[model samples]
Target: MTQISINGVQRQVDADPDTPLLWVLRDELQLTGTKYGCGAGLCGACTVHIDGQATRSCLTPVSAVGARKVTTIEAVDQGQSARVGQAVQAAWVKLDVAQCGYCQSGQIMSAVTLLSRNRKPTDADIDAAMGGNICRCATYVRIRAAIHEAAKALA
Candidate 1:
């Protein structure tokens, strides 16, 4: 059994060590917020925070996780204590960042990570941090706007 700290809870998962963390999260843990996109890790749809760094869960092995804290979109708000995440979420909603919404979870996760590192990210910084996440709806404009808005809110 492989044990992992998901969100903030420790759970034992009975799966192959080589199984992708994405499957473990979606299939076993039922934390479906992290979507599977470009199973090769090219897309950021499966983005999650592995020890506070935005990681592509689809290509990460369950065994590799070890003792790292896995933060998903479901717990992005940190149960109301995540100021950065809440601000990003609020900005997303306020700016209407989502069109189809399939990629919003990953987008939000990446945005939160970016804001955590750089409280005042410029357009280039936002683009660099979010370049991997693809929104089929082409909502890049709103996404960038929301990131700027979130950064201002955080400031």
Candidate 2:
């Protein structure tokens, strides 16, 4: 059993160290909020925060996590990231950014990371920060809007 820290809690996950964190989170820990999209890490559906940085869980092996803290969509609005997470979630909901909703969690995660670092991101900044996250529903317009609104709410 390997000990992994998840969402402010330490969990003993019985799995191979080489297993991708996406599988460990979904299958082992049942933290299905972090979805598996492109297994090759091309898609951002598996995005989660590792030590406050947005990372693709599909590409991150469980062993690589070590002592780093992992934050999934389930408890994003908690801990030190609370303020930004809540603002981003509220903006997402208020702006109705979800269509299919499969990629929203990753999008929100990326947005939260972006907002946490840059409180007021411009259109270019938003595009740059959210470049990795792809929304199949073509909700890019709304996603951008929500980021802007979230930044405003934070300000």
Candidate 3:
């Protein structure tokens, strides 16, 4: 059993070291908030924060996680990211950002990471930070607006 810290808790996950963290989170740990998009990491649906930096869980081997704390969408509003997470969620809701709602979790995760770092990201900065997360519903405009609103709330 390999011990992994997730959402501020330490738990031993019984799985192959080579198993992707995405499967570990979804299958082993049942933390299904992190969706499995393109397993090649092209799509960011499996995005999660590893030690405060957004990481692609689908491409990340469980063994590589080590001591990093993994924060999924399920607990994004609990720890260090609580304020930012709340703001992002509120902005997403107020802006009606989700259409299909399949990719919103990853989008929100990336947005939280961007806001946590920059706090005043411009369009270019938001684009640069969120480029990896893909929203298939073509909600790019609302996504950008929601990001801005979340930033304002955080400010």
Tens digit of per-residue lDDT, candidate 1, span 1-155: 98999999999999999999999999999999999989998879999999888999999999999998999999999943399999999999999888899988999999999999999999999999999999999999999999999999989
What TM-score, computed on C-alpha atoms, does each candidate reach? Answer: 0.97, 0.99, 0.98
Better of 2 and 3 by lDDT: 2
Clash list (residue pairs), candidate 2: none
**Candidate 3, run of 10 with poorest lDDT:** 36-45
Q: Pick the candidate with the highest lDDT.
A: 2
Model 2, range 1-155, lDDT digits (tens) per residue? 88989999999998889999999999988999999899887779999999999999999999999999999999899999999999999999999999999999999999999999999899999999999898888999999999999999999
lDDT of 3 by residue, 70-150 (tens): 999999898999999999999999999999998999999999999999889999999999899898898999999999999
lDDT of 1 at 28: 95
lDDT of 1 at 26: 97
Clashing pairs in 3: none
TM-score of 1: 0.97
